[model samples]
Target: MGKLTGFIDYKRENKEERDPAQRIQDWQEYDAPFSDEVLSRQGARCMDCGTPFCQMGEEIHGATSGCPIYNLIPEWNDLVYKGQWKEALNRLMKTNNFPEFTGRVCPAPCEGSCTVAINDPAVTIKSIERTIIDKGFENGWITPRVPKERTGKTVAIIGSGPAGLAAADQLNQAGHTVTVYERDDRAGGLLTYGIPNMKLEKDVVERRIRLLEQEGIDFILNTEVGKDISAEELKHTYDAVLLCTGAQKQRDLVIEGREADGVHFAMDYLKGSTKKLLGSEVDGEQSIDAEGKDVIVIGGGDTGADCIATALRQNCKSIVQFGKHPKLPLVRTEANMWPQYPNVFSIEYAHKEATAKFGEDPRQYSIQTKRFVKDEQGNLKELHTVEMEKVQDENGQMAYREIPGTEKVWPAQLVFIAIGFEGPEQEVLDSFGVETFNQKADAKYGKFETSEANVFAAGDARRGQSLIVWAINEGRELAHKVDEHLMGSTVLPSYLEV
Candidate 1:
């Protein structure tokens, strides 16, 4: 370690965020970058623990304990501590292909598993990581690394999200001729659309895509594989095909008045907003304007929070979010101890913005939406909900039961259903003859293979919806699998192999 007693000398410091009240006025990242000296001091706080559980990258109790990509966290922390910025960036890029994306959005399970977090504040791993990469770009250390020779083996990647991008980056480095197919007008699938610009600005995604293009990977946009181009045609044309299409089949609220005009799927609403921000045609229709409308966002996850933040920015009259489950404890409970992802309640950026703008937090836990109430014009007018309590079912399993006579209604001119995702769209799977692992089954990792030869799947498409870090991990692992299939063996590093 560069500083053996640095953890004792330095206190944990996090990156400063822009004032929530001012940041919500526009669609831009709110985090203010840290100076190199401050970032180095933060990196010095990483203790040289014997086990270094921060990079263990294991799943404990169905939740990730550390970085899924197994980033060499301590190594870079040491390099950064010694003011070796270039060395830190090199170590960071060794495990993570896109530090900028993960640094901005990942929930930082790595920090939760940090040794320091057992008794004190954890090292600022995410912010330090962002600084290292951002400095790399600023110093021109990151450049296109075009392969010296092509393997002459062609590969087709279906999807341009994190998984597809990571796979393309790896396969291109391995000297394979890679062509990525995206159904959207732009290359980035979720990064360009599903996530709001306020969280991750569009230019950050585009910069990486441009670098990939310069490195010999070709991108074909607005071209659906199973629709615009047949899967059979791709199978015949390319040597191997990898599916990273992502899990986008939204879980619907199949209650009454689901056909109301102002009710929309979360992705549709998010994509529409992002498209309008980018000056792109949003399905050739105007953006879903939440201005002056009472908004009700269902689901208590990140997507729902994004909806709340977006609505606030759009100058909505009022905002309320509903979560089916009970509120989590403000601190980690005995059941969720160290090294596992702490199931504790913490405010995210969007929630902070909501609180700052609305004078109170907008989340209401243990509430379930019963149905949408619509006006005569068939537009949503209100949302009916009932408070729920946890109770034991007949089988002695925990279940939610509605409190009798606890029904209530809230004015809602627009409703965003952000419940969750079921899995990948079936059309893409059916087209490729792929069989999905039953989600009900007790499998840690889902199936990634299709019935057809040389066809593979990864990320959300195979494993269902998950974090960006997990998606990158899946893409890197899948790339090695595809490479092995083509060359009879592979030299690509597998982070999970640890």
Candidate 2:
């Protein structure tokens, strides 16, 4: 530990964001940079508990808690507190290959499970982590590390998302020749296209890609497996093939007038917005402008919240959110007490911006979208919805039941279905003869081994849609398994220590 009494003497601090009114005018990052001294103080708040639940990738109340990659949180926190930034960076990179991405986008489950959070506020773990990495980059501490020798074994990985990148990083460290194939014009998968640039800047992703290129990892852009190249061809040419394709199939809304012109999937909207911000200059053609439209986003998840924020940037006239579940309590209830990731209310940055502008919370809980009402031009005009009550279905599964008297229509020019993803896009999987473990598709997970003997899978493709941290963890773990399958043994580190 850096200081014996650091936890008691120091208080937690977070990096402040820019003024909402000013930030909404542009698509740039809004977080104000904090000084090194303030970040060091935040790091010192780590209590360094004996059991250190922060580093333990535990499952509480059926939800994964703590760091999924098993990040050495306390160790790095101490290193940062002691002003040994280089060492802190090294310790952090030991488990997580991309702290820069997770430090920005992760919900910080570690903070939720922090020992200090039982009564007081949790240590500013995410802010401290971001600072350590940003400082590392500014100080020229991060550099490419090319492998000493080549193992003469080549691997082909599909998808350039976090999982695919993590797998490639690990296999390359073991001296294997790794090549990643991406369908998009650029690499980084969702990190590049799906997520809005305000949350994770495109330049941040480009910098890391540059380093990976310098380290000799081959990235093939605009090359899709099932379309341009055959999956069988990839399997024949490489010693091993790892499928890291993420789940991209959007869970759809089946309702009246669903095929209207003004309705779109959340991914389509997010992808278009990011492309526009990155100078694709196609927003005018593909972008749905909320400038003079009343927008109602269906589903109140991260993606939905992002849609709201993006709409605000476009100067939307009005906005409201629909959440199927009841509002969460301010604190954990008896059912979600301790160690578990509490299902509680959180005003995310996007929600905060919307509320500030709209003069009320933009979300409506326990509400379900029933249908889309379209104008004479076949454009979506309004959302017909009703309040819902949860009840058991015929299969003994919990499902939403619409309340009879709560039916109402809200004006909406643009409707975004942000329900969630179903599973991996099945085109490549079916063509490759890979069986998915998930029922939604034909591919199988867990063994990760596909229908073919040498084919393996990981990330959202195999495990279904999840957080960036979990995807990285799955990628790192699968690399070890694939390495052993190819070479009979390996030296790549496993993120899951247990």
Candidate 3:
């Protein structure tokens, strides 16, 4: 707990984001760091409400609340308030393996569930967390701690995303020889390519990868499991295997003019952009060119927001994003209460930059794309859309209804579909020969074991597309399960179980 009545005395303040106009010019991070004094004040905002839900890390009515990794938020907040940076870092690292990643990209569900948020603004937990970890690294408190002894057990983790990396870190620390296989040249999968650098700098991801490598985790990059290396081969080689390839099979728009030259998947567009920015070979993939072109991104989610930001960085002439759902209320509605991640309206970094430059928000809510229009040469020219309204059906179930006479067309030279992913790559899943249903790996929830012996799955592969925090949670849980299988009841931490 922080100072008594600190939530009442000190107002909630977050680290300021760099100017939208300036930040749009480069791929560097836009968030400014909070000083120690400011971090302490923000930490003081954590109320000493006997039952601290900020660390509950549970779901209510299918909505996430608090820190998924079960971070000891209050303890660290109190430590930060008392200027105990080292102790705060220790407590923070006990649950979270990569606060830097979560600090930047996590939606901070913990803040939404904070007791103070029920009345006043929530504590700046994300900022305080980032400060604790960053300061630890700055002061040389974070160093590689290679395992003292080897368990003679080997684990092969597929993918280098949050889930794979977290599992690898935990297993390697448990004295298990861990080798991570990544299809990309770099180790961080989503962190390196899926997410744009402005929101989360590649350097931050690379720093953590370096630390993991120093901690004795082997990384075999540019090697696809189903292609470069066979699944059977890996299962026979490693004592255990964990699949964390993620739900990467992107959903497609199957409307008219589907094969327009300019229409592209949002993930491919982002991957190509990051590859070009990092001077990596695109391998003949079509790269995005939004300069002087009108860009339209379908699907109003974080991926869509990233597309808007990426297009802005390329100086797109105009940008608009479409969402099927209605605009969220300015404040929490009756159905959307305090504990769940607030389903309320909040401007993202890209929205700010777009508004600053375009004079209005780039989002169009309650809209549905009818089809894509094409030009003479088969390139994208325009997009047909219609407005949608909420209406109850005969059974009293809420559904979307298209409003007639509201059909419209918008000029679009480039179209990016950010409709999200479907599931893991079918080829990889088939190669593993694991049971699957509804596009998810069929594995035991608590143990993460697949049908095949010594084989397991976790994260997006097991569950569908989910949050990075959830991915980390699954990875840690899988590590515990694999360790238990190998050593007959292990000591790995499974926070979700707690």
Per-residue alpha-carbon lDDT of candidate 2 for residues 63-92, written as tens digits (9 for 90 to 100): 768888888888898888888899999888
List per-candidate RMSD values in Å. 1.7, 2.5, 1.5
Best by lDDT: 3
- Superposed on all Cα atoms, model 2 deviates from the true structure by an RMSD in Å of 2.5
| TM agreement with the true structure for every prediction | 0.97, 0.95, 0.98
Model 3 residue 13 lDDT score: 88
The local distance difference test score of each candidate is 0.88, 0.84, 0.90
Q: lDDT by residue for model 3 over 1-498, one digit each (tens)?
A: 999889999999877889998889989988899888998898887888898898888777777798889999999999999999999999999999999999889989999999999999899998888889999989999999999999999999999999999999999999999999999989899999999999888988999999999999999999998789999999899999898999999999999998988999999999999999999989544477799999999999999999999999999999999999999999999998988889999999999999988999999999999999898999999999999999999999999999999999999999999998988888887898987734232333475877888888889888888889889988888899899999998879877467
Q: Which candidate wins on TM-score? A: 3
Top-down TM-score ranking: 3, 1, 2
True-structure RMSD for candidate 1 = 1.7
Model 3 lowest lDDT segment of ten? 436-445
lDDT for each residue of candidate 1 in 1-498, tens digit (9 for 90 to 100): 547787889888767899999998999987899887987888888888898898887778888899988899999999998999999999999999999899888889999999989988889999988888888988999999999988889999999999999999999999999999999889888999988888889999999999999999999998987779999999999999999999999999999999998998888889999988988888733369899999989999999988888888899998889999899998889999999898998888888888888899999999988989899999899888999999999999999999999999899889999999999998988888877643323223434566789898888887788899989988998888888788888878877466
TM-score of 3: 0.98
